[model samples]
Target chain A: MLVGTASVEALAASAPTISAWREQAVELRGVTCLQVTAEMRRAAREAVLPPALHPTIPAAISIQAWRVRDGDLGAFDFVCCRVSCRSGVRARGFTTGACASTERASSGLAGIFGFPTRTATIDFRQGYDGADLRVEVKGKTILALGATSPEPMGPDDVQYTSTLNLAHTPNGLRLVQVEAHHLASKIDRLTAHLDSFDGEAFGDARLRPYHVVSASIASEDISLPGVRFVCRPDELAFTGTEPVSRA
Target chain B: MKFGIFFELSTPRPFSRENEWRVYHNALEQCRLADELGFDHVWAVEHHFLEEYSHSSSPEVFLSAVAAQTRRIRLGHGAVVCVPEMNHPIRVAERAAALDIISGGRLELGTARSSTWTELGGFGVNPDDTKITWEEFVRVLPQMWMSEEFEWRGKSFSMPARNVLPKPLQDPHPPLWVTVTSPGTELDAARRGLGCLGVSAAGYEEQERRTKEYHRVIQQCEPVGGVVNDQVHTMNFLYCHEDYRVARDIGVPMVTAFNVANAHLYWTREAFPTRAYQTLGNAGAAMKAKSRPADDPSAAKGLPEGVGVGDPEHLIATIKRWESIGVTGINFLLNAMEMVPQEQVLESLRLFAREVMPKFRDPGDRSRVYAPTTVPGFVSDPTC
Candidate 1:
């Protein structure tokens, strides 16, 4: 009588699945999944704003990460990210437009520009090339253009832009490789990105630690080369010397 | 005024697929009949992985099926092994609550920390930690019942705040009981404020003394788990026939065989090095020794001391003595190890109900005659 009449299928379907990209791969040593997510959200909110923006933007984010310690090769970590602008405007009369975008990027440069290029699409495109890189903002600039003006201005006329990046880390990227091997199929998209491009528009954008990403390795192969990544989903710590900044 | 039958669905000695199903269906049929016959309760034992002695591993499943069929007879778990290793406390609470709703609150939760080595070792349970785990379970069960979002960080198990659903139909909870086979356990049950289910097959004098001790300890009991105080119930074997000699000839051996089989299964743990004491070799030898035909008449003498195996008149007399000794109710062990035919056991139950039960039907007349005046110093109250 202690066992309920509820079917296993009903229970399985109703339980929540991992949601939120910012929270995808952060790990906590001795904590429940819920606690880990909460901690990740706190850190995302405290993250420094891009230098070009005049004022700090208040934002919220979440992530979901999973690692396979054993069994068939698959995603080591999958994450989703979201951000909302609290304040800032281009002009007094222009209507504010909110845009959302989703992208799948690799944790490794080999994965990012190797065989297949990971694509992130936006609403507008304005080419801005740095010293050796051509960076394109696909959507309307954060600042609104005056309706009466004949030409549009850039950063001088804008407040801030809303952008979200969803990518796999080295550990997470490894998992994708293992999963490709496990499924017995070649990875056409990521492989093409890795083989075709070098330091083109992103000029060793691959060199940027933030730009560098990795996939999760199969849990069974936790000891494989460059695949033994143990990052707490709850704890956010910066590693490399370069600080995070906007282009 | 509750009357019920305990089923292990035991199929000892002559094992047959037909006989096994026969015993099982008979118990289900008995529950239906007991409901029709106006019996107040029908209980089953929960055991795991034991072969012939017990096949009723999942009592909840069996009882749920029983619930579907019976309308009036309350279904009871004589004792649920409340160790975390075997079952989680939350699972136990949730399951019990669901059963109560299914059975219209006719579920009685009788719990205990298991004593046998076979059950303990097979599940990797530590003997010394049994009491602690049981106490923790008892402590947490009530919170699970009362709170919408229950959370606890105990020594053994911990969980975050979450509402545990499908609470029991009974207000507060079902009547909780604990099984006790020894004198110390009887007193312990009283101090914990749980119902004492005395299962030892002891003489009338010993039963009287233990019952008295239970009442004495219960008077000052500050409840440990949920309830404020405890209730007490005793167990006895029952078999009735038209002729005293006929009943003695058939029923005595069956009861004797059950006792020997149980003792051998559990007591042999003292000899083995392994945590699991169940050795098929030892159990088989014990059964063989017990079933051996006596060469001399003196070897197969009078009823094995404590067993109640006789005609209607004798059974009634035995029950009266138990009542006089201050025991609340007697759980009759009707069909044990399939020693007797299903039909014969049913006949015994019917005859006993017709001839013996009516005598003790009055609620006012059944109250304990001697109330204990004070609590003994050795009996410490259980702390939740």
Candidate 2:
């Protein structure tokens, strides 16, 4: 669980003009599965009717279990949304349910309604020119009535880490429990299976089920940064480079 | 990997109403040829009120016509805008069901939330609400198709319990897909167990990563439809030729023109000044101003780097790379900005089928394979 009070900063003075990427680290409060499932609609209803002094809504919300880039990290996606607080203090970070990858983020988010805490923060680093992006979530007093649907692993989902919850508490809202389930995914299997292709599975393997598809590399004259041209024997020379989000 | 063709139905500058007719007829002719030449799918995009960039607003009508003309090729909605403001849920289901029945169930329904401010605002769709509306629209769309009589009361709409007619020929309805342009949408698509229709002209490196990520995540994705269509289609440019240089010369200009024309669209950021446009404009190539390159055709002789736009060898190599990366399908943007003459586009399709398709054929087609020494007006690899 990636939670707790947190502050983190990373700067690389590669070049004052530009650093291929800048020191783009900031703290962000996550918009929980609860907020997405409830608050938006409730905000709409409150607009239509009277504003509830204590807005309570029951929701059986199924969170799109966000997969991490690695163990306890952000998603493979690198998108960011900059949020500004009432104090005019602004922080920018990836707009992903990344913090949901942990029991800590769930508990901290749950703390907002449960304990009525002033603010809770956490530290996480994205591999953005190797810099840390920190986020601080200010607790909201709006009471919600709903239990988060337990995070269930998909048909072939592989669970490497933890889970987050959105449980309604008499105190407010708290994450009931976060646990790791059993379901090894094809993604995890890819990492394990990529190097084992011994060229024995070429022609027959083309029709094989549960395999990744790719186009052969071209561009003889022009060199691409991380592309390998497929040789005649049809063997792969993979770069093992991770894809970065333009986010 | 499957090979498919895409159409935006662009009518280039220096034309009037006659060009629109020419564009549609030319596309129909192209589709006929693709159907005969053994292409997999003919995916048409849905765009509204955009001049030159895309003239295809009514995909069902166009696809219905294509369906009547062809027999084998799969009919796909590159995406039908899922925002209720743009298209009512029942209408999409009815039309898709009708098309599926008409086309003998060769329908792949791809859905999306309107991105451009032009389409969204034009149809009175709130930019902020489009995502939620899209989610609701997809969730209930299947219910409408599957249930003989369906009723829905949600944030988006309220439809009384009534029989939605014309059940699809495909059991339970057509395969559902989501048009993904924004980064990280693949995961959402997987979570809902929908196909990832990558509309962007993302390079192979990016496509490879996306495909890998998709296959990885989709295994555990919860299905939004009746069943998961665990497929990924990478959109690309296709202008195949006998000569590598000729293919490069013809295809690159079309790509650049298409990109430039597409970028000129009135995004939400431009009009509303806040909302989707700001984030997407910075992230997409839409904001990049483009100009017509000088008349030196050699200057335009190179294909879009990391795209399938060169000669047979280049395309073969590129398709092979994408196949190796685990892309289940390759969606080729056949005509862009109307730069390529219709005759040339048809010839390019024929040439691609002749030279490139054979390389990826199943084991049964080994007898038809083109040998290395048969240059066939193309440059043979010196390395070979």
Worst 10-residue lDDT window for candidate 1 chain B reads: B267-276
TM-score of each: 0.53, 0.56
The models' CA-based lDDT, in order, is 0.48, 0.53
What would the per-residue lDDT of candidate 1 be over residues A1-247, giving only the tens digit for each residue?
0001222232222222212112122221211010000111223322221111111111111111222222222322221221221111100000011111223222221232121222223222111210011112354122111111112222111111122121233322111111011220111100000111111222111211111111111111221122122221212111211211111
lDDT for each residue of candidate 2 in B2-94, tens digit (9 for 90 to 100) = 778998898876668898888999999999999888888899999897767788999889999999999888999759998887788889888
Q: Model 2: chain B TM-score vs. truth?
A: 0.88
Q: Which candidate is the best by TM-score?
A: 2
Model 2 interface Cα RMSD in Å = 19.7
RMSD of each: 25.4, 21.2
Clashes of each: 56, 26
List candidate 2 segments past 4 Å from native.
A1-247, B273-278, B281-301, B363-384
- What is the Cα root-mean-square deviation between model 2 and the actual structure? 21.2
Runs with alpha carbons beyond 4 Å of true place in candidate 1:
A1-247, B13-17, B225-229, B266-301, B304-306, B363-384
